[model samples]
Target: MALALNDKVLTEVYGPSTGTALRIKQVAMVVLGIAVLAIAAKIKVPVPGSPVAMNMGTFAVLTIGAAYGPRLGLTTILGYMIVGMLGFDIFQSSTADLNGINYMMGSTGGYLVGYVLATLALGFAARAGWDRSMGKMALAMLLGNVIIYLPGVAWLGVLYGFDQPILQWGLTPFLIGDALKLALAALLLPAIWKLVGDARK
Candidate 1:
């Protein structure tokens, strides 16, 4: 009986050990996710007139959230921001231009801040197990993207002045591209989760 009890205890503990191992693997994966996001942010697909560029960082963000859930997703994005602020050429620009704190607070700053919030939103959805369904995942990503856009547009208006022409230049032109990005992220996140799940199984 004692031996049987010991075996049962070991079985219970085994799941916890596996959980710990999974968490460790998740941390490493999140770090990799951050690096990929930084690279994606820098690779601009040209869109005319608007400062809006095709950034695939959103895809990485969603993937991280879907795979690891919320806390790690937020941490990974914050880590990316810290690295970029500390003179890493991880921003949209390829060159390392760390002039001052203001550099971090410049025009696209809100978008950077939004990355965290957006990840949190998606992460929460994913934690609720929405990562398996493409439609639900798409909605989650769409909402996440909106979270980014609201603050981004608000900051643009405040910094660049609340003029109609500024809205035209800053916000309007990028809508289509942002929509496409949302669609892409929606498509990619569930697929990534499937690949990870299959690998683990």
Candidate 2:
């Protein structure tokens, strides 16, 4: 389906859109988004050679951005970061013993920064109606992953020295997982839009 460039985001389409109701809906979405991020962070599998675990946190970030649009996407990610910064175990490698700023400054620090950029990128792509097409959504998801990994790999190099196998450590190991997520989001978002379109009819 060819959604208009100005089409509403998923959140906008389902919720109250005026005054007090809109504010309440936005607040509720932010809360729910944070919860989803936290839960996804914990659902991880170890990568044999990489310090960063394979996790669904990035998938949650991408989906939230595409569904929530820029304003709310940014808000939700910032809220999640703030909670993690406050010593909450709301990150992939975070824990009670190694939580807060200290943990954030570890190897995962750059990826954390990339999360903000990726969210904004996906949110804007969704706003432009890219999320309504499987091809466009896949491209958008690919771009979002690149946005994330650029800062992430760069940070790894800086933190661990350029001589280190930064790509192997930070980028290569995650490709298969990220590609899987990209494909899934691409398929899922367009399908959801189809459902919404059918429901409206």
Candidate 3:
């Protein structure tokens, strides 16, 4: 259940190489993860009253983490967040349309923050080799979603206060979508692994 330092999906697919080569590949993967996340952020459905948009961002988060493993995955997540903070329009429409620190102060900020935590939680799970199988990855993805939602709900509750219920503003609207995303991820990760396996043979 533990991933050796080099036991990540990409590492498995490509096989081990010199430290320099690995470093180069890791950097490239991080950049690619950021790009994919930016694209995922754009695919969204606006939820009324609530600042949080339903987006594929979470799916990209867990998928990237599972692919990149803990260390590189964390680097990529933090990079994505920071770049958005620098006004890259990297967030979903709700926040991407926003500028500077204002977006973080927006209703969607908590969820964005949740993306960071969720990526870490799932990345760690990936480091534990959870990505190698569908069931374990499903659990890892569900847990990752929880990690995203908790801070999201808390931040939403604090920002809006008692004026709106946190569930309405943040949590309740996205449950089904998140479930669907999780199921898709469960299948996707193992399929990618299988493809990689087939390629190497």
Which of the numbered candidates is closest to the native, going by highest lDDT?
2
* Model 2, CA-based lDDT: 0.91
Candidate order, TM-score descending: 2, 3, 1
Worst 10 residues of 2 by lDDT: 1-10
lDDT of 1 at 70: 70
Better of 1 and 3 by TM-score: 3
Cα deviation at 15, candidate 1, in Å, is 12
Q: Residue 31 lDDT in model 1?
A: 77
lDDT, residue 64, model 1: 63
Residue 26 of model 3: what lDDT?
76
Candidate 3 lDDT tens digits, 160-190:
7956787987888898999999999999888
Q: Write the per-residue lDDT of candidate 2 for residues 121-192, one digit (tens) a residue.
A: 899999998998999999999999998899888989988999999999999999998999999999999999
Model 2 spans with C-alpha error above 4 angstroms: 1-5, 198-201
Off by over 4 Å in 3: 1-6, 94-97, 198-201
lDDT for 115 in candidate 2 is: 94
Q: How many residue pairs clash in each candidate?
A: 0, 0, 0
